[model samples]
Target: MDSNSFFWKIQAGTAATPEAVKTLGGKIVRVDAEQGSVETSFEGKRDFTNPTGAIQGGFLAAMLDDTMGPALAATLNEGEFAPTLNLNVSFHRSAVVGPILGKARIVRRGAEIAFLQGELYQADKLIASAVATAVVRKQAKAT
Candidate 1:
């Protein structure tokens, strides 16, 4: 596998199932999902920090977006899949290099759209939050 593409393996199974989350020298501590909620954890390492010695803001935003986007996407009915159309994130605090946890839930699911909210936390403190909207598309062709 290519180096950068390795991160694509960080995926959880559909519904309530757990899946392996590939680490770029980091680890996924948890990934639990209920009917409308999904929670995930990621261990931050030195490589994830910016030159300024703190977790980069883009990294924090990616965590929040992934958490929120999937919480809605995973809820699609059979033969359907959802993809993020727009994602907006707001930073409330900086996340240091350490373990960070993120949680998300579907706020609403309309006929063809879904709205979700999620947050990233460091050691139990909120660092950032995100809101996302997705368009439900027909499932892609299976390999």
Candidate 2:
């Protein structure tokens, strides 16, 4: 490992699940292994609409989770995974079905724990933000 290649491990099929990337509709704009950050852009499809005609909050959380989780994951070595212990999200505006953007950063990471922050943007507006805590540990690879 070159010390700055953690993110590539995920991209190169060495860690995590396929759904971690697939659920975003196959859109990953950037991954910065050296900075421990990841960025994503996705379409807020019509299938995610709530009864009142707004995008549901859980979907937003999923986007935030995927973004922040990978930011933490990109820092871990092979055989290591970070599972979310808790995630706190705040909604700023009602997001409709449209283009959505997300960016996450690993704030503080220790031996056992890591802190992450993420922001969701739509039309250049800050719509949602999240802070997450996760545990880093080695897990058996699925067969």
Candidate 3:
């Protein structure tokens, strides 16, 4: 793991994973900075379910956002961060309360922006997919 990589920092416990990610039960599984790709696993808790007992679409969207954001974050230089500008998600099949795998990769990247895509899967079935754009920004230095 490159020390400069944000994902590596999170994995090494040098930096804290966000509370929202914790709520999603997210864990970083693999990262390939050169390839601009990452794999994450999330526990879809029953609390995330809707009236149909399936995971709510909003939670699934958050999972996808968490997935795709890291794909770009892993490649960022130290002291830099990317905030999602827009996320467009499509729900395919309802997901149950269990382990869900997320895979994401950078589709394109420019100096200041990146385009990303990702999918959520459970039991080898696609649960949802998403495309997102993010703008890279330098972290503010503490005064």
Order of models, best lDDT first: 3, 2, 1
lDDT of 3 by residue, 1-143 (tens): 24776767887898898999999999989988889999999999999999999999999999999999989988888888999999999999999999999999999999998999999999999999999999999889899
* lDDT tens digits, residue span 1-143, model 1: 11111122234322332232334222334434346677777766677788888888877777776677556544544466677888888888878888888888888878888888888888778899988888877766689
For model 1 the TM-score comes to 0.74
lDDT of 2 by residue, 4-114 (tens): 344565576674546645655535689786798989886787887899888899888898988898787777775677889999999999889998999999999899999
| Candidate 3 segments whose C-alpha is farther than 4 A from its true place | none
Give each model's whole-structure lDDT: 0.67, 0.81, 0.92
Better of 2 and 3 by lDDT: 3
> Which residue pairs in candidate 2 collide?
none
Give the clash count for each candidate: 0, 0, 0
Off by over 4 Å in 1: 1-34
Q: Considering lDDT, which of the candidate structures 1 and 2 is the better prediction for this target?
A: 2
Give the residue spans of candidate 2 off by over 4 A: 1-10, 13-17, 141-143
Q: Could you tell which candidate, 1 or 2, scores higher by TM-score? A: 2
